[model samples]
Target chain A: MCGALLVRNPKGGLDRPIALYSTALILLLLANIFPFLTLEIGGRQEITTLFGASQAMYNAGMGELAVVVFLTSILAPALMMTSSLYVLLAVRFRKSLPGVRVLLSWIGHLEPWVMLDVFMLGVLVAFVKLGNMATMYTGNSLYAFMGLIVVFAAASSSFDTHLLWHKLGIPGRKT
Target chain B: MRARDVGLASCHTCGLLLHLPASGHTHCPRCGTPMHMRKPNSLNNTWALLIAAIIAYLPANLYPVMTVISFGKSQSDTIMSGVIYLFAHGDWPLGLIVFIASVLVPLLKMLALLYLLITVQKKSHRRRLQRTRLYRVVELVGRWSMVDIFVVALLAALVNVGAVATIEPGAGAIAFSAVVILTMFAAMNFDPRLIWDYQGEDNG
Candidate 1:
């Protein structure tokens, strides 16, 4: 991780993450709008959206679990992509946006909480289990969710934090 | 030599090295995060959160995480039972994943954190690199434990059929989520630099 931090501009400037983040945000929006998966049993079908999972937990009275699922899988990724895009845009435009530093720091803290990759695996496991019980059909949002995960990884890895800090005029390590 | 030995403190949020004030704490000039020579009371906070997670791990495993109600019958599955059901039903790969992320990962993370906290408290100077790596592993794997919670959420959401069949998240899901979250907090509270703080006589 530190090695990734020290290497500056290996993939050129913020253009990669900027382009990738824009793509990710669009994908995220698509993921939220469409149904994620459809469950069919005995000629009845149930469609679940991105927020449906958390809503289910909340309905089951497990509000804490609901919040956890929502925050890690949904909210965190959205916040990360949007906030990162904001910082990158601020840097690109050279506009001294208010609270960019704090937002960047918050983005750093938000990194681990973005668990779309894990949630994708969870969806797969859910698929296998659901496949046994009933017929399952993947939805448009599922594809978007998968794409968001890929593009999110690209954007996050391609983002050069050291370069941004330099551009922000923050000092680096020194004795 | 450590930064503390030279009256320097690194910003936890932005990783900038700065001079420490003679008294009291100061915010990072660049990012405004509170600056400290080390995460103040790191071990205490980690131990408290880790112990809480350990306690939560009991209910997380012992109780049912989700209940499958189908055709006038109800079946509840604990974390272990769910994995067993998957493996018994020939879903070994997914079973293996759930087993690792839900069961092995959380247990090993807490135990590893316990070990690191002990070593740091003991001021043991051996294998600092390995301990640091262990801290990284703990931090990295912390969030993956949420995979099971997510699976439970997804299952409960999609398996609703209104009297034909329904899956509801059980108490264990909440407990399990608590365990994952507490361990994450425990990992974040730990300062890996403390592992290397015993390097020299003057620093000690």
Candidate 2:
């Protein structure tokens, strides 16, 4: 027999993930729009946005690195957040949208590729490394990016895939 | 007997037992996901991805991962040099963390996956449970190597102080990130159920 494990969502169910995901979406927007970090030294000032870093990498002739940074830090997170919102909202409205199953599967596959939390930690480490070299100021995006990490983690943990499958009318084989 | 031996396979997306169809075009009645006894062409796909990752791993370690320019003097550091710099600077904990996440984790994961691929191909029945656990560990820790890429991105973005001090991503970061992503895909393509497939033959 092919044994399959099924899990039930704890108390509060999908409500927590919905809230966290909504907040994460907002934070992600802010993270993209604003400057990510700023540095000043020897009377020269430089500002870099999230997208700017990727562009800078591309300009520096590291096209592949730019794509990696862009995809993991930007594209993957956006896809995860939006697809999750689409599924969670559809389930909330008691509507099984077309491709809900496909979307859900994409969310599962994209979870690890989304690295906002790791990127946030990277920002911190960069700050520590650059502390003595020059005057460094975190831009608004840094704070937003940090918030996105926490919110994304919370949203993902509380997201009950089993509950979603059930709502989609998938019969669960009880172990 | 293994599940496949009995012509039954479980839906990976949903917990539904599905009978393997003769033509193998079955779909899970419950989840709507296409059902298969094992990931189709798992070994071939994984081997291709693993080879690509191995090729990337060389430049990932050889070239400078990041460049530091301070006071008109620029210095590029490879991944190993960065780790050594951290340790030499008395930041042992962070050094260790970087070392494990960037260097050790990817290396170990590739080796583990290589072992699994070889054993499954050989139909080795030894340590089936342990091999399954090894796959799980490899899948779990594969993403941690992004730590190095993130560090590069963050520093490059934050430390753009012109001639005073600036950080630029080097070719190594690209290759390194490719290794991490490719290995992850390789792990995902590898089906753990294959580990148990050899058990019935051993018993017989």
Candidate 3:
């Protein structure tokens, strides 16, 4: 009972930010699900997907790293997208969720670290490194990943989570 | 449990538990009265994760987290080298980001935890909001810290050249991942309650 956050006005409606973000999130999901990377080693061409990346890591003797990468980058984003979409669907239906205020706040807190941008950074870094070593080709998956970065960023920026609780029928929650 | 027991609290603006002497100013600087001093595991768990994250932080920074062995001579690249490589190759902005998010950010976050724990121990009163914000920043940014590792995983898979070059994550990657996870937990376990505790009141 030490500190309680107060929201003076909670009837704020969902706007462009919400719609754009929902669309972006769906795109991000497609980017991850379809293929986030491709494998082309030793002339044995194989179009490896994200799941294949996990297998690649394990083969490279980095099993733990594989799991962590899959969990946070692969799995967590999927979960976040699904959750946000569900919330948007609920909002569209004009349903009220108890404690929607707290949920939106939690989402805000979690948003900044989603890190798809960072992954893109890594991709660039890897391309540089691989370029120095050998003939490194950028795959279609990487292209999709490039698109994903924009989608993820747009999703994060355009999502005014403060308005989330409002659309959910809980007014006075945007603190 | 008695209201009278809790009534010893000083003011409304800042919660400060009033001194028993009653002669001195026990009111809060901002919001007076009953500051929440009690945190369930303020020092213990913070210290534990702080130490673990610290331990994990060393190998994370020092050693080559990802090594690409190729064609007789093996070349190992640490996170910094990878970032530098990016910068030198005309991707300075991206390099700086990876350096900051993967290297600098994680280190600062762990160090901040250490600072917070120590200050909490010393009962130092100051900049509680800033400290809390710092914690939030670290907590939120921790996931981004995995970018480098993800890159390694992605590349090691996508660009494998068989005998020419093969990428493998080294011991440093595990240690770094541990640091990231431990620091994340450290942030979580850190009761935001302590911020107000130092400011002055007892949290019920």
In candidate 1, residue A98 scores what lDDT? 88
The collision pairs in model 2 are none
Instruction: Work out the iRMS of candidate 3.
Output: 8.6
lDDT for A78 in candidate 1 is 90
Interface DockQ of candidate 1: 0.62
Supply the global lDDT for candidate 1. Answer: 0.88
Identify the superior model by TM-score, candidate 2 or candidate 3: 2
| DockQ of model 2, rounded to 2 decimals | 0.49
Q: Chain B of model 1: TM-score?
A: 0.95
Point out the higher-scoring one by lDDT: 2 or 3: 2
* Two-way DockQ contest, 1 vs 3, winner: 1
Q: Which runs of model 2 end up more than 4 angstroms from their true locations?
A: A1-8, A170-175, B29-32
Question: Candidate 2, TM-score vs. the true structure?
Answer: 0.91
For model 3, what is the error of residue A91's alpha carbon versus the real structure, in angstroms, after optimal superposition? 3.3
lDDT of 1 by residue, B23-124 (tens): 637988778788887788989999999999999999999999999999989999999998898888847988898889999999999999999999988888
Ranking by lDDT: 1, 2, 3
TM-score of chain B of each: 0.95, 0.96, 0.75
Tens-place lDDT digits, model 1, residues A25-87: 999999999999999998999999999999999999988888888998889999998999999
Q: Could you tell me the fnat of model 3?
A: 0.54
Q: Give the per-residue lDDT of model 2 (tens digit) for B1-204.
A: 667767888777765677888775588877677888889999999999999999999999999999998778889999999888777763688788788988999999989999999999999988877888888889888887888888787677666756567788888998899999999999999999888876756586
DockQ of each: 0.62, 0.49, 0.34
Per-residue lDDT tens digits for candidate 3, residues A26-95, read 5655665565544445565545565665676788777887787776666666666656655665666767
TM-score of each: 0.95, 0.91, 0.72
